[model samples]
Target: MTAFILVAGAHTGGWVWRQVAAGLRDSGARAYEVTLTGMDGGGGAAEPGVDLQTHIEELVRLIDRIEGQDVVLVGHCYGIHPVRGAADRRPGRISRIVHVDVGVPEDGDPALKLVPDQTDRERVLSLARENGAGTLPAPTVQEWQRWGSVAGLPDDALARLTEQAVPQPLPTLTQPLRLSGAVAEVPTTGVLCTANGSSIAVVEAMVGLGDPAFQALADPRVTFFELETGHWPMLSAPRELVNVLLRAAAGKGHRVAAVREQPTHLRPFLMDVEERPRERTGRVDLHLPDADGPRPAVVFVHGGPVPAGARPTPRDWPAFVGYAQYAANLGAVGVTVDHRLHELTAYGRAADDIAEAIELVRADPRVDGERVALWFVSAGGLLAADWLAAPPSWLRCVAASYPILAPLPGWGLAGGRFRPAAAVRGAGRLPIVLTRVGLERPEIAVTVEEFVSAAADCGAALEVIDVPLGHHGFETVDPTDASRDAVRRAVRSVLGHLRVGTD
Candidate 1:
């Protein structure tokens, strides 16, 4: 008799496997059902959020606890997450891994990026926010059943199933499965259920043949089975599920079986765009969405165009924390662009190209046709400041940090044609620069004074903040308390000037 180890899905305890275990035990096989963390009637793990690693740990414990020297691991729904993990831990001792009516483990893809699409991502995030007090939410047992096709189950079994459901930790669902030393090379079988004709068909199809993101699981060593039933096959078709498991345990090959309907692909056609060559165009290109009304857009045409591998990250004589997603999350479309070849572009060329990119963003639906702002750091900012001297009607706001060579000659001031104070003098409002008293360089102070003075003439709001501890890039290291404070203030100031709302 084989020792069968069963792994339950999300929000389910080991009790859900009782009937199947009994059937196997009656057949003279020892069956062990493994319950994941937070499902054994405990308060659930708090503080350090539970992730894929944590679930894998629990599974390892279950496998180690079994008295026999043999066991066949079975997983259902999210059970695939840990079953794959255990297989990697000990391949020799385990006989076979069975994924029962479950979504295939998506290897290499970020877990947080799951769900059907971006719109769904937003919905999930909204749900998480509503349930977990501004954090991620752990769904209740009742809630999870609603997500599946459970109406087809017999009333008696359905009632017991709900009673056995335990709230699962939200962290396990969201955390990306790190695969450095994690397991994947074990003999496995997928019992895919796709008869619901539901939106979950995507996930069902993925279980039959996992998504492209984590597609390495479809190797020759892996076996596939089809279960034509509702999502909860344990209650709806446990005999069929168990039969497949028995074949796997017996190490049999080519065991013919019946299924309601086989999965079919729509024969997707690929149109991947490969860039054709272009010679020394030296022009700006903007890509925007098609929509009515104003949309938020961010055009970042600021990199120094350093040769490949020469420059590691962006340059800030005084470093600065980059906010790539910060703008994207605020309903604004953010763009990151590399500047044209040279530092100085034929006098008026830089401004003109910047203007082009801005127009492209303004016309994009995702950007709401709103006049998007420009982002330039150091050298780029210096040029941007020079162009801001005579602003356009659509140009809503302008912001630059540690701008070029100022008249007063700051610590980083060098021989450059552009002066940092130029934008300050021309602006109706003041431009902002990152600075602090303790770490202040005399040259930076001069730069600030020059820009502040110019901003005063233009009647523009001028802000020269003396950041307490650091000069720039405060939030690069640990998401520390002090760094977060400084970055938050800086973000608010910039957004306020741009007339964008931040909640």
Candidate 2:
């Protein structure tokens, strides 16, 4: 299967990739537009806190589930910074790099810190602050003129851009790119955008400074191209951009234009007092949305339930970090805390630990005390289901994946997991479940079966989906069909259920 993963620049989301995606499909390639975190409108905005690593995690997640062995990655504007890191994570996963109106000029260092000293990028922060902690519209042509002349955009084109502009989350501009080993090894090409040459900080500066890193891709693994067009290629020149992308997909380089839309966090974090503690320490990384409106918070429990504060080996794998970032991107505070032997030795005692954490977060004004959700991975799902049994008003939704029906009469197991026979009698909304068992692991078959039985007995709405994947670990990465369907529904359902709590 041929896959094309397209991403937008700052001030835009995956929605902008729609028409171009359609065009690509009509031309016979499977294409997907990705809306990176901090871009979408409903999710709100970042705090003085959002950074580059956060943005990269979101993009890598989109790259994870792509069906083809390797995809042609197309990133525009600052998006190139993050996708390059993603390419670093999986050397062969992305076969080609298409930088629309973006170019490496040089490898120098990771692009994370390659920022402009001018006000062009900083203006977004002022806009977001004025708008109350959310994305603001991109500068209009009239607005762009305030900085410098946009060398080439003509009349009608420049006029139409103003109404369509949206504000960008400040982090995308401020965050510097973080490089992984995969990035250093991947083959890449840059499609330098110069239509509005005078307005581009990098392009206009190139006359004297040369490439940012000085012919960074001079090694055997890189190439370059220059395109003359306005920044919004999808809208300004969809056909031109599509044709450019098609060539890149075919292993060449080109530039394109497009249009798009664009995207938070604090804490009452100290309340979870562990009395019957295990030999482990827990760290809760809560990302509070920035606003007075009632927002939701998510508790992230990894699938393997690894030790607390231990980050996955990001440099070695493509699936690390994105899990927790998912919740943060959605304007929900994310608490990826660690529970030790308590979660393993005593199930009930372990669960209350999470409950206390919820109440602690509710102490914050940003979270609507009544509209919080809990999101868990494989084994974590079992624990979350059990905890939600007597959930507080704030614990509004539950999203569990590949959960066990019962290990020991509703027990969560590190070993022999068969769906628990437990029942959650709470009136909380139905859970969104994503489960997949290895074709060879029959217990995987019963994983969802057991969850279904418990949901029916519990009297809650349950959206359960099964997949043909060989292992239970697929949901954490970019998801396949069965897994994505379940996760997408679960995310939507959890958001909806949280609303119910607010009511």
lDDT of 1 by residue, 82-142 (tens): 7777767766678787877554555554333433223334655665566532233344444
Evaluated against the true structure, the overall lDDT of model 2 is: 0.53
In angstroms, the error of model 1 at 385 is 48
Measured over all alpha carbons after superposition, the RMSD of each candidate to the real structure, in angstroms, is 22.0, 24.6
Candidate 2 lDDT tens digits, 333-384: 5555554422233444446666666667677665667666777665556566
Model 2 quality (TM-score): 0.42
Per-model TM-score versus the true fold: 0.44, 0.42
In order, the Cα lDDT scores of the candidates are 0.53, 0.53
